[model samples]
Target: MILVLEKASAWWDYAWLTFKNPSSSFVEITGYYIDRYASVGAFLRIAPNSSGTLGVQTHLLQKGQQYSVYVTIKGTQALEGPFKVQLPAAESEGT
Candidate 1:
């Protein structure tokens, strides 16, 4: 995830998660949650050899939040994650 590239003047902090499927088959990411809340604009489908991304609003941090990513592939029992949700240390602490 990308969180280090933030500026103090920014109103919202950002983080990113990206993935590529190496197989020859198309896949759908049917679920995505961050800190137990569903992420906005999370992907529903990802073409083969293509990538998918999950975004985080790090500006919304609360006492150094705990978060994770989860994915369920379509038409299969394949499960891809519970990946750690990491953000760069804040540029500056704010109230």
Candidate 2:
């Protein structure tokens, strides 16, 4: 199993997280962000040689603050990340 968190794009309140299951068995993923103590139920069923994406919401996130993101495979101790993500300051209205 492979997990990756894509660089956050235009969305100020969420980030795109991708998971890949390269083995010949199906896998499920559950995730959470440490800073907010919020759990994101990705619970994806990724088949062999397949991948999926989940949108991790940052609604509780603050600009310039770093958050630790983690994902774990269901029914196993396999875990990934403390993936650090920092949100850029929101653009001000009316320059």
Candidate 3:
């Protein structure tokens, strides 16, 4: 199974993580920040030979701060990354 971090963004007090699974086997993903403080763990089952997007929510996402995200597959020794993502600065009001 292969895991890819598609996109990551922050709004208010929440962070949204988007992922893609492209493989012929069901995948279970566990993700967390490298700090090991604010973390989220869940099993994402993407059907075989199909592509699906998963949105995971977490708290305390600072704007413009680069985050190291760690992802691992359940029941397997497969580790994707400490993927680095920089949250874009929040949009200002009135464009």
Candidate 4:
């Protein structure tokens, strides 16, 4: 079963990180970080050839530019990235 957090809305300041299990076997999530804050779910499980999404907390007041998000897989190497996504500008009230 998949669980989606209601707080994951368009107006959220946090960055959304996507993770995938490359191996044919299932992979366990050891740890992940969004900037400085740790992920809410630790020791999470992912199916083989499956993917999971998590919201990485970010604060614009602290950073003026960009930040990085990384994940550690159990019995495997850690993947790091300064993942970035740009949201489309909201339309005008009248438009």
Residues 1-95, candidate 2: write the lDDT tens digits.
36545443325777566666667777777655455486667666777777777677776677656677777778778667766666666773122
User: TM-score for every candidate vs. truth?
Assistant: 0.54, 0.69, 0.64, 0.53
Q: After superposition, how far is residue 41 of candidate 1 from its true place, in Å?
A: 8.3
Best by lDDT: 2
Cα error, residue 55 of model 4, in Å, equals: 1.9
What's the best-to-worst order under TM-score?
A: 2, 3, 1, 4
Model 3 lDDT per residue over 2-95, tens place? 7776777555545556666667678777554444555567666766655544454433555656777676677767556766666556663123
lDDT of 4 by residue, 28-88 (tens): 7666665666554556677877777665555442433445555666676555444554322
Of the candidates shown, which would achieve the greatest TM-score relative to the real structure?
Answer: 2
Model 2 weakest 10-residue run by lDDT: 1-10
The residue-level lDDT of candidate 3 at 54 comes to 46
CA RMSD per model (angstroms): 7.0, 3.4, 3.2, 7.2
**TM-score, prediction 3:** 0.64
Better of 1 and 2 by TM-score: 2
TM-score of 4: 0.53
Candidate 1 residue spans exceeding 4 A from truth: 1-14, 35-41, 56-66, 89-95
Clashing pairs in 3: none
